[model samples]
Target: MYPTLRVRVSRIEQLAAGIKSFTLQPCDGGALPAFDSGSHIVVHMDQGRMRNAYSLTSALDDRSRYQISVRLEEASRGGSRFMHEQLRENDELDIGAPANLFGLGDGAGKHVLVAGGIGITPFMTHIQALARQQASFELHYCFRNRDSAAYLDELPSTLAPDQLHLYESDTGGKLDIDALVASQPAGAHIYVCGPQALNDAVVAAARAAGWAAGRVHFEQFRNEVDATGGAFEVALRKSGVTLQVGADEPLLRAIEKAGVKIDCMCREGICGTCETAIIEGEADHRDQYLSDAEKAAQKTMMVCVSRCKGKRLVLDL
Candidate 1:
């Protein structure tokens, strides 16, 4: 577990009608840990009542300050609204060290980036890195409208206008995943981060285009669930105890209810803090943090939101 650092908002800019860019600086002028383009920080808010994850929108090389864009989610569970409406300059907030599961590799022949709505946060860092290296890359950004698009003005001037393609869904023409995937050159690497619908479309199209799994990388904003989802019994291997998880209750909650303390940063499964080893039985991996191979091996599981596929799972607490 990483120690929480104190951060204060130094600057705030209204990027769009409901979106704002918050520039944060450490309370003490110490250099923060170096982070990659796709890394994110987990903000500890309201005395740990909420832990929200925000991607690093600033360049990795520039460590003096960090930036994150917050969009007002009316139906939000409360984090985004707090940041967007309640936060003010000089207000202190607790932030975790950077954690990343999405990053670019140097060996990729070419890069194709796809961003939807606020998903552009991480890609901003990717573009900065690629630009510094003068790598061949293209970005396809899809949004509902220009007014709702965060950092719209800064993107065109940052990258070649021709390499940046903007698609406004309200205009009637959707982002043709088939055309986008087909347009990529041979041996190109595809990176996508977006909502569930956009991600599904892109992955489906990429697979249909004969792109190998190794050549495609993606980060999902939400956890994917299995169709036959139901609660099961979980046995703590170390303690030799069992708990019956309720239908709507997550495994993490069930474990906590049984008096086992586990450290968890993001309950939504984006952060790997709650990961614990699974000694036996099949796990229905629902998290976006781990890779397919990691889940297949059943070495570790995010008990916060993930459940078991078998009738009973043995967990290494």
Candidate 2:
């Protein structure tokens, strides 16, 4: 794990009805760390060790401050609630160094950005970079309505009128993923950060239209939970312990509950810190960090999200 940096909140501004942008500066009064176009900082929330990842929205070259936006989500895992209600402008917090898994590719000449709701935060940096390089790019933002759109007030001033497109579902405006994918130039690359449904739709459409997998980029944030999680038996070969993991419990939690501690950073499986060798059984890989070749090999699995393809599985743990 990288060393944590202590930062102080410099300012807070409400961007929308329930969305607010926070500006953070180094508490020690030093320059903040440099970041890439689409980097994210992990915020350690409250005292519960709840780590929440927020994309950096401020300019990449600027070290004066780092900005991150948060939407109040009462139904969420309390991270958003802490940011909206408990966090104050002068509050000090510990944050992780910049990490990028969804950064822009320099080789891609034309860029197409598709954002849903708060997903536009990461693309703010990308937009500035594209403008500086005088590259061809377009942004399509999909929101529930005007009130739910967080960055509308600033986007118009920052982006050209022809480059930005807003689609409001409440007003019968449609994003039309199929049509959007069909309309893109053959070599143009697409960057997506949004809800699972929106991401899945874009990926599916791109693949169906014969777009290469390398040309499609996405930011993976949360743990994947479909209806497929079922009770499975895990065999810890090194410890000679067998544990039953329930549908509601993550594999890491089950292992920890059995008095086994595995070194992990991001439990969402995007960090690849909890990856373990698969002694036996087919792994139902669900992590965004692993490549298709690695998943097909079935030599390792991220214990945090992956499950056993069959009833029982053995781990080197």
Top candidate (lDDT): 2
Instruction: Please give the range of 10 consecutive residues that has the lowest summed lDDT in model 2.
Output: 219-228
The lDDT for every candidate, in the order shown, is 0.81, 0.84
TM-score of every prediction relative to native: 0.81, 0.81
What lDDT does model 2 reach?
A: 0.84
Model 2 agreement with the true structure over 1-317: per-residue lDDT tens digits:
34689999989989998989999999988999899888888887785345677889998889989999988764665678788888998999989888787778767868999999888889999998889999999999999999978888889998999899999999998898999889888689999988878998999999999999999998755722331388899999999999998876667768877888786656677778889999989988988779999999999999977888888999998
The pairs that clash in candidate 1 are none
| Over 4 Å off, model 2 | 223-266, 271-273, 280-299, 305-317
User: In candidate 1, where is summed lDDT lowest over 10 consecutive residues?
Assistant: 220-229
Query: How much does each candidate deviate from the true structure in C-alpha RMSD?
Result: 4.5, 4.3
